[model samples]
Target: MFKDRTEAGRLLAERLKKYRNDPGIVLAVPRGGVPLAYFVAKELGYPIELILTKKIGHPTNKEYAIGAANLSDYFIIHPGAVSEDYIQQELFVIRTRLKEMYKKFMGNKTPENIAGKTVIIIDDGMATGNTMLGTLNLIRQGQPGKIIIGVPVSSKEAVEMLSKEVNEVVVLLSPEAFYGVGAFYEDFKQISDEEVIFYLSQLQKPS
Candidate 1:
């Protein structure tokens, strides 16, 4: 288990050393992945961007992700799992949340373009990988030159599922007995909006 997200990020950065100073953008899953992406972007001297995708959950079981969507696009990962009305409602709610989060995280700065650029998607960890898959699908719309998955830890199934969809996968650990993402981290605290803003501010300062 990692001491914390910072340590996990540092170790993950070492594995991604080859990409240092390359033409790429790191798109981190917000809140949890921001801290980890900060380290990778800082290490590689690349800019860090946020991939704002929210899961469209099932009507009966909120925990069950039927699909995922961003501002411009939405995908129903599980066919006929959720109704059109549910998806529409969730999409509207998610868009509102995404706007608030984007404003809080980056203020007026527009998101970086991914076309013709190597895209590194970073997250603290993954369990089912559905959310990340949704993010990837959205990113695909941008037609990135390459897509890479970077995570500190993930389940075996998640790794396999992601490996086929992306150009490369860099995961620190993928244990067979994986219970949850937090189980692999010693100090997996809930990341706050202020913390996310702080990291973004630090990264944008003139070097």
Candidate 2:
């Protein structure tokens, strides 16, 4: 098991040393991804950005994600019978909250240009990877030079699924016996929004 997110980020950075000084940007899936992506951006001397994507839960079952929204645009609905009205309401609420979050997390900073630049999307880990996939769909529309997925650990099934969508997948561990993302980390505490702000404050702008 890894010590924490920082340690995992350092280890992942070692493998990604080749990308240092390259025209690549690190996009992190906040709240948990901020710390890990902080280390990567520091190591690679790249600017860090946030991918503000969230899963849209079903009306009947809040835990069940019927779809996901990316940066207040682009919604990917699951291939199932979900009420259009429910989806619309969820989209409006989710997008409104996301804009608030983006303002809090980013301040006045605009999103980095992904067009023609290598984009390395990082997270602490992935469970179902639905959130990441949703973010990927948004990223693809920007026409980046390449899209890479980076995570400390993930389920074997998630890795296989993500590999097909992204140009490259960089994972430290992909164990078949995965129960959940937190199971692989020794100190998998819930990341606070304040902690996310702290990490974002520490990011160095690309030179």
Candidate 3:
């Protein structure tokens, strides 16, 4: 078990030492991932950017992710699982919210180009990995030189599912019993938007 997200981030940064100062970008999954990514990005000497993607939940079961979408692209695991109308509607709503989030966190700054550069995606943990699969599809559109997933803890199934899609999966813990992500942490408090902004701002400061 981790003392908290800070400890997890430091440990993850150590594991990623080989990539220190590599020409790459560190993408955080927002909120929870920002803290971890801050440490990792600082250690690796890479810029930190948010990967703004949200899951398109199944109609009946909103908790079950049918796909994931960003502003420019989307990917559905089960093509015929949902109707085109529903997908379009979700696209509008999700993109609208994403635009707002981007504006809030990034203001008018242009997003960094990831093409031909190593892309390391970081999150606090992974559960089912469906959302992450969708995220991978979106990231591929950028044609990064490599794709890596870094997480503090994850279920065995999640690691297995995600490993196939990315060049590498760096996970600190994968317990066989497989409890939820928060279970592995002594303090897993929900990260707030202000905290996210705080971390991002710190990265923007002159070193």
Give the TM-scores of the predictions, in the order they appear.
0.97, 0.93, 0.98
**lDDT score at residue 16, model 1, on the 0-100 scale:** 89
Which of 2 and 3 is the better model by lDDT? 3
Q: Report how far off residue 156 is in candidate 1 (Å).
A: 0.4
Per model, state how many residue pairs clash: 0, 0, 0
Between prediction 1 and prediction 2, the one with superior lDDT is: 1
Query: What is the alpha-carbon lDDT for the whole of candidate 1?
Result: 0.88
Ten contiguous residues with the weakest lDDT in model 3? 14-23
Best by TM-score: 3
Task: Give the per-residue lDDT digits (tens) of candidate 2, residues 9-48.
Answer: 9998887777886798999888888899988888888888
Q: Summarize candidate 3's per-residue lDDT along 1-207 as a digit string, tens digits.
A: 999999999999999878875689999998899999999999998999999999999999988999999999999999998999999999999999999999999998899999998899999999999999999999999999999999999999999988999899999999999879999999999999999999999999997
Q: Give candidate 2 regions above 4 Å deviation.
A: 205-207
After superposition on all C-alphas, the RMSD of every candidate to the true structure, in Å, is 1.0, 1.9, 0.7
Superior by TM-score: candidate 2 or candidate 3: 3
Order the candidate numbers by lDDT, best to worst. Answer: 3, 1, 2
Q: Model 1: per-residue lDDT, tens digit, 54-109? A: 88888898777777888888988877766778788999999999988888787899
lDDT of model 2 at residue 205?
36
In model 3, the runs with Cα more than 4 Å from the true position are: none
Error of 3 at 77 (Å): 0.5
